[model samples]
Target: MASIPPAMAPSTANWHWKNKNVTTWAKTWFERELPTISVQDDGNEVSVSEVVDVDGDVELGQRKSKYVPPMY
Candidate 1:
């Protein structure tokens, strides 16, 4: 009788979601949409907000953004 080899784990290096590779599309969309995003504070008169910091783990789908209101 012949012995079968153990199965290998599936590769997720190029996967974005369930069996689909949407990295390119998602990345492009995120880049385009990022510039249009704005964070505003309702308590104060925040006329404009500038992106002070941006950091996150893309693979984990985690993102953080810090906005600073301009000073007169």
Candidate 2:
């Protein structure tokens, strides 16, 4: 898998992770951009201002993975 880095490296520290699998996955996942999709609420039509979280970091930051694997 050329897209995948040839190594598994952990960020942060050992003390931060109780589960090694999750920590390892996080490292790999962090190297890619997460997808961003926008969908309307199926039940209602809400204004952008009504749903936006201006104060939260979740609204401010982006996901890592730039591509989606073809198998997906």
Candidate 3:
């Protein structure tokens, strides 16, 4: 998107041109952009335990829980 004019601040209504059709332009641009990120985790087990009542119940704002390994 182009920068907003200095004298006129940006508002939700006029952020971008509403009538102009830019569907083709957007599709073409994204086709060239490649995603290059990958995530892998070592073989490990994570355990989460409840800290309050084992009955699986707690009042609002009166309950606390934590992960067993504390890293997950």
Candidate 4:
């Protein structure tokens, strides 16, 4: 469905990804919230400083079409 000149389109056949230090979106939250997530003694011991529970609600509905077909 796209109409464009071939010369203007960027070629991805020879594209090479570069290694860069990209920051993660959840890195800050993990460090601040789950700093105590670790194991000890051959992964036999575990600890958690805090725990959080989330709750939510959702509603569903249907509406009739506003358009009416013209009477022939």
How many residue pairs clash in each candidate at the backbone level?
0, 8, 0, 0
TM-score of each: 0.33, 0.18, 0.24, 0.21
Candidate 1 — number of clashing residue pairs? 0
- Tens digits of per-residue lDDT for model 4, 8-31: 223343243222221232343444
lDDT of 2 by residue, 11-62 (tens): 4543332221233344334343232323468776533222222231111111
Query: lDDT per residue, candidate 3, 29-63, as tens digits?
Result: 33333222234569654443322312222111111
Give per-residue CA lDDT, model 1, range 5-56, as digits (tens).
Answer: 2222344442432232334444555555556655668664433234344444
Which regions of candidate 3 fall more than 4 Å away from where they truly are? 1-18, 35-72
Give the better candidate number (1 or 2) by TM-score.
Answer: 1
The global Cα lDDT (0 to 1) of model 1 is 0.38
Indicate whether candidate 2 or candidate 3 has the larger TM-score.
3
Residue 51 of model 1, lDDT score:
38
Clashing pairs in 3: none
CA lDDT scores, all candidates in order: 0.38, 0.31, 0.31, 0.36
Candidate 2 wrong stretches, greater than 4 Å: 1-21, 34-72
Which numbered prediction scores highest in TM-score against the true structure? 1
Q: What alpha-carbon RMSD in Å does predicted model 3 have with respect to the real structure? A: 20.6
Best by lDDT: 1
